[model samples]
Target: MEHRYLGNSGLKISEITYGNWLTHGSQVENDTASKCVHAALDAGISTFDTADVYANTVAEQVLGDALKGQRRESLEIFTKVYFPTGPKGHNDTGLSRKHMMESIDGSLRRLGTDYVDLYQAHRYDYETPLEETMQAFADIVRAGKALYIGVSEWNADQLRAAHHLAKDLGIQLVSNQPQYNMLWRVIEERVVPTSKELGISQIVWSPIAQGALTGKYKPGQPVPAGSRATDEDGGGAESIRSRYLHDDKLTAVANLEPIAAELGITMAQLAIAWVLANDNVATALVGASRPEQIASNAEAAGVTLDTGVLSRIDDVLGDLPETDPNKTQSPATRLT
Candidate 1:
């Protein structure tokens, strides 16, 4: 896979990062997850993204086992904090210093690693002071637990404040992870500009809009069996339905079939390539329960989309994409 520098940092990561969010320890068996991770490595993917809260921390354990034999220096491992993982308690979650300290130790123990390449805040902690959160991150870096820091789904204002604090604390905050796809452009308006100005690149997740852009969920058809839309666990179906399962969105996605055929790529590849077309996007994150899925999606890396193809995508998905700057919101209370 092609690699790029994450923001202005010297660290280089694969353009296509394999992520285990809902699949590793929840949707798929451990053996299946291992196969998928192997497939990613075979495809030359050197970056892996996971979170401590994913599958109640089972995902990290499964990923660590899957990556056990590889040369750790050759791979970039990323995980996040700011979510409840252990038994519910006042200090069990959020980005407070106590929670971050406890969480990083637990994450390292579960991931079987002494240090992670990047540690991110899963969300902006409205309850914790920004200074406390950034200072804790600085301490994590100073302690050699994580090399760099990042934030996920943070608004432009939140990012600016954190970036300033990170600079003041001598922390290298190099990336921001956001939900960016052909169907979701919420990051394009303000977050992208602010992050770019702050020397931070974006590691975007859900480039396929949870498989809606793949045209697998046909408009007006029954939800496909075995698809995330049909998954009963983890509110998967409900989440997709609320955002991308609408008839209008599905129909718009279907209209891109000929475009994908003309380009000799799958709809999924087309969607991923579209996200990578942005210069500020350092990587596009993809999650899979099966090995073949990673093999196919990895091809999107280094595959450049021409201007006409991009225009066609915009024409088809016109006005359906959410670009509201105000949509980048954090929960008032920490998520359980």
Candidate 2:
């Protein structure tokens, strides 16, 4: 896999990263998770992104278990804070110093790592003061528990503010994990521009829109058996089989069949290549339940999309959706 510098931070990351959101504990079995991890590593994917909230922390444990015997120093491991891992108690979540301190310890324990390459805040916590959050992150970096700090799902303004706060305090805010894909163009406006200006790289999650772009589900047909769409509450919060995920404007799976055949690439490869077209994106984190999924995704890092193909894709994505389906927060109202 191709590698890129994660913002101005000295860390280099694989262009295609593996994520353990719906894959490790929620969907895939232990052996399957091992295959997925092996596929990623064999494909030169060194970055593995997980979070404390994913599968209630089972994701991290599974990932750690998968990476156990291999060389640890070569991989870039990332995990996030925020999101309640415990009950509804205030200490269970948010970016406060106490919560962050406790949370990182728990994360380290679960991931079987003493320190993380990058530690991110899962979301902007209005409940915590900015100082408290930034200082907590800074302290982690100072203590060598975290090499770089990042924010996930935070808007452009919040990201820039965090970057400035880190700069002022001598902490390096390296990357911002956002949901960016062909179907989710929300970051094309504010967040991308702001992150580019501040030299913060965008590590996009759900580059394939939770496998929707993979041509797995046929519209007007029964949901693919055992697919994420089968989840009662939706496999993921944003993946509730919406109109955007349908086979409507984006020319569905059938539309891309010819293109995939021509390029000898899958529809998922096209979607991932499109997301990585932006230089600001340090990595596109894709989830995988099966080893083939990881192998297929990692191949996308090498696929090239010419102007004609990109325009055809643009036409397919015409006008674009104002609302980002993958994101919990709307970019327009996120800062407001």
Candidate 3:
């Protein structure tokens, strides 16, 4: 497998990272999570990404139990904080120092780790002062509770502010996590350029666009059993993720099939390979329910897309509307 330096952090990571977003927590059994994690490790993927709020709190435990007996130093653990893990309250979540401090502890306990290789603020908290959030993260770094600090879903301005804050305070903010894929290029307009300029690497989530790029769902096919698209629950469960099923750009997926067929690869491989193809991407956080899925996802790490194929891909879907038609907006040409 190929490896890349995580931004300018001096940390080298596998291009593919196993993630437990929809598969762990309560969506799949512990045994399944274990199989996925080990399969990823065996396939040479060395990083895992999880968030505090995934599965309402069980994702981390599932990961921790899965990693048992594995060489801790051989793998990297990344977890995010900021989303509410409990009922809404002023102190229940966000990047406030109070919440940041407690959230790290809770995450460590659940992951069964003493230190996270990277601890991220899920996003900018408009209600909390940036200074408080930076200072809290600095403390976490100083205390050796976290090896590095980062943020997710943060805007370009927020990223600039955090970079300077960390520089002045002598702390390192290593990477930014964002949702980036052929199906979603919003980050490319601003976030990707900023991260590239700031020397911060981007670890992309939903790198597969929640399986939309997998090409398993035909436009009118019934949602598959045990698939996230059919779920009814909304608390970070597979059901909760079905909202993406309504995504506007999924029509774009159909355009790539002929190309995927030409490459003798599944749409899934083509989509994942597209992410890895970008030099700006550091690691792709992949999700899965079975061991084979992890293995399949990892193989994409080596699929190279030449210039012509990339150009064809761009010509097909690069002009998708900004607001995600499945979510809120219309085609770009009609937008005022």
Candidate 4:
């Protein structure tokens, strides 16, 4: 797998990061999750991204157990704070000092690690003051619990404010994780430019639009059995159904199949490569339920799509992509 520096920071991560979001401890069995983790490691993916909120903290335990024997220094493990975890108490969520301080300890205990390579704010905490949040992160860094800091789905203005605060607090705010793909270009207009100026890189999630860009979900056909669209409980079925399940989007996605065929790669690879074409994107986060799925998606690490190919892809997708920068936002209020 190809490796790139996460931001202006010296830390480097795999271009294709293995993320266990909707799979481990929720959608897939533990044995299957472990096998997928092993597949990622075998494919040279050393970066694993998970959140404490995923499966109500079971995902971290599953990932830690899966990665038990390898050299710790050889891997970069990441977890997030915010979102209610552990009994969902009043103080169990958000980026307050108490919640962050307690959440880091819980995350470490579950991940079976003393320190994480990166600790990210899963979303902007509207309830907590930004100063309290940054101070908590600075403390975490000083305590050696996390080496770098990041955020997910934060808008351009929010990123600028946080970057400044993190700088003043003497912490490295290095990355922003957002939903980025061929069909979702919300980060391109404002977030990318602002992040590039701030020296923060993007570790994008759902690079295939939750498998819609993989050409597996046909335009007018029933979603294949067991696919993300068919899964209702823990499989992000609502997200896929509400976002890109329409025939207009599916038909546009299908038009890109020939581009993948021409490149001798799968539609998934084409989608991933398109995300990586942006210089500000350091890595594309991918999740898998099966071992071979990880192996196949990892092949997109070093693939390059030239300007012509990218343009053709744009032509095929043609305005179906969401490019409005305003769409990149966090919740107006913390979820209970």
Q: Provide the lDDT at 271 for model 4.
A: 91
Give the per-residue lDDT digits (tens) of candidate 3, residues 18-83.
988777977788987898898998899999999888886789989999998888898899999887
Model 1: residue 127 alpha-carbon error in angstroms: 0.7
Give the root-mean-square deviation of each candidate in angstroms. 0.9, 3.0, 5.0, 0.7
Q: 1 or 2, which is superior by TM-score?
A: 1
lDDT of 4 by residue, 7-32 (tens): 89999999999999998988889999
RMSD (Cα, Å) of candidate 3?
5.0
TM-score of candidate 1 on Cα atoms, chains taken together? 0.98
- Candidates in order have lDDT scores of 0.93, 0.82, 0.81, 0.95
Worst 10 residues of 3 by lDDT: 327-336
lDDT of 1: 0.93
The 10-residue segment of model 2 with minimum total lDDT is 327-336
Question: Which stretches in model 4 have alpha-carbon errors above 4 Å?
Answer: none
Q: Which candidate is the best by lDDT?
A: 4
TM-scores, all models, native as reference: 0.98, 0.93, 0.90, 0.99
Model 4 backbone overlap count: 0
Backbone clashes (count) for model 3: 3
